[model samples]
Target: MIVAAVPRFRHIVAEVWRPLAALFVWDVAVTIVYYRLPFHAPELPLTLFGTALALFLGFRSNSAYQRWWEGRTLWGAMINASRSLARAARNFLPEPHAHDLKRTIVLRQIAYANALRCQLRRQPVDAQVLRFLSHGEAEPALARTNIANGLVDGTGRRIADAVRAGWLDTIQQTQLESVLVDIANAQGGMERLKNTPLPAQYRFFPTLFTHMFCVLLPIGLVETLGFATPLGSTVAGLMFLAVLRIGDDLVDPFANTVHDVPLSAMCRTIEIDLLQAIGDSAPEPLQPVKGVLW
Candidate 1:
């Protein structure tokens, strides 16, 4: 969600302040131990441990950022797909949909997007989408299938009916169906990410390595650095901890939080834009709160 990096130290302090505080306590313990110890530093292999921890943290953070970036790009594709699908539906015929019929299907598609975003979050379909249904209709539509699956089926049915009514050609129906497939595929891909968690061992490695170095850092610094052992260990330990937690923060793409995929905002944008196309005068744009869109 935050594409551009802000100040690095500020970012780290904000995200991992608790862990940093814990590490500060850790540093105090190490400082006390050093004052009472008989032996410490260079020969204790501090350089090797620090270098290795740094490399691991860098690699882990980069990999997690890549996953987050890829998810964002896919959602960008979904935005474009939503707009294109609406256009295809409205204009595939000789004339665009009349103000009324066009509004219904367009609203339906908007409902579909909102429902799909909510489904990804594992939340109930939002009222924006639910308002389109009565209680009797809602139960059956949502019974077995996921919101995305149901919405796609409804879209297919609408397109098929349009063909039957001689409003859209067979080719136009097929073309419209193809657009739905792309949207369906995007939803499925996000669902797959939700279903398939990051490998436990893969995530564990960086965390384990970072903590391991932090635990060892004070002992290594004790002999040469004395009271400064705490200072050095705290600095190094907090850095590793900060980066490791940052990696963990981005691993899940569909927790529906603002940082995850911006699914709700993107879906709402789809709704507003498509409503505009259908000539709905009541498009209400929802703004992201505190730079986060839920």
Candidate 2:
């Protein structure tokens, strides 16, 4: 996500340049037609039209922001649950006897976080995921349609094994299982946001109305603004255009754009914490590149 206090001008311009260019051209054409041709500028209720358009854009923008925020919130929950799972695996499992097993479960928790990140973004299982899994473990998990869910299931089975081996009692197993459940719930929430989109009316109508308003703007103002029609109309139309673009930019938090939730950085955080918990060296935290955390 964009972490800069002030985003670059080029980034802002890149989002709206297409519509901005179209509005400017259309404004100029309308001004020319009014002055050179025998066209009569129609008096439009521009003030009322702009008011209604602003409300439409405002609602769409709000809905999109809610989706983006919910995605971030779900990941925050995942991070917390991952840390809890790692701590439980390290402390609950009998030391020295279950040393290797404890480490395996903790490492697999890290793998699960990375796998969920890749799954949400629809990316392939990279080294970030495979490095934490043993050859035998990776094969079956990768074969499943949902790798992250499979990894979570594996962790639960291992916890159950520890109970059978007398490394953990039934109570301790339940506690650890509860943490895994929290992680699964967080994953489900993220999947819901990624799969379900804003309704068609919300997506289509505001866009249609905003463009229609821009098209009518120059004609409505030509008689009153006269030679300044292009300047007045283009500037006015830009406000609505910018707001329209805001909704589209925030509509999908997992789209892997700069505006998306920083899933990579978040997964790295889980890796660092879990690796260090099990007495292994961890990589440095991910830093923002060009003011974007993704």
Candidate 3:
């Protein structure tokens, strides 16, 4: 979701400062203890442990990245499906009411995208969604727990109306419905990703090991590094902690954070595309603010 050329150091520090500071304190305290007591942790054990931790960190980051990539893929499908529907509406629908019906379908498509975005991010329906729906339509759709699904069903109903009214033929209806099905499938995939998460046990162990290793790092290095142990251990701990945080940040791509999937911007894209398709003046595409798209 972050569109910046470079990540802001202040933001990174804010998220990881607590753990980094704790590691610094622990490292310094352990180094002092080693100086006074002549007790130092074995480098062999720490080296072996760090290696194992690195492997686990790699696995964790891969899993989290998969989730992030999958979320992005689903949104890409959504974009394609919306465009397909617009094209179908433009080509298949009979005249007289084609423009009006096409416009309605396009607006509903925009609403569908917004509803999904809001649902994933756990935000209320925004002005964009309200603008697309009538008071009667908006009230009932917003009241539903699954607003996106409800809007999708509404789209189906519109297709049905178009068919019955002879705006769309049976073959044309089938084509449009196929595109709707694709949209629905993408929506369901996104909902599944939102509802589920990486297992707690999978998340718990690596964090525990990362912190434990960080706390003991200075103890392991104090004999060799002497007064430099704190600096060395703290820097190493920061590296480990940074990797762990990256995985954590990517675990939930729909959480409306800077590191999330940028659903707001994506939904805006759908709005712009669908609006322009119906010969309406489309709103400007969303631009990143301070290098963050969402």
TM-score of each: 0.87, 0.97, 0.96
TM-score of 3: 0.96
- TM-score computed on alpha carbons, candidate 1: 0.87
lDDT, candidate 3, at 134: 82
Number of backbone clashes in candidate 2: 0
What ranking of all candidate models by TM-score puts the best one first? 2, 3, 1
Residue pair clashes in candidate 2: none
State which candidate has the highest lDDT.
2
| Candidate 1 C-alpha error for residue 200, in Å | 1.4
Error of 2 at 119 (Å): 1.2
Q: In candidate 1, which residue pairs get closer than 3 Å at backbone N, Cα or C atoms, i.e. clash? A: 40-223
Off by over 4 Å in 3: 40-44, 126-128
CA lDDT of 6 in candidate 2? 93
The lDDT ranking, best first, is 2, 3, 1
The window of 10 residues in a row where model 2 has the poorest summed lDDT is: 126-135
Tens-place lDDT per residue, model 2, 152-248, is: 9998888888888999998898899899889989999999999999999999999899999999999899999998988998888878988998899
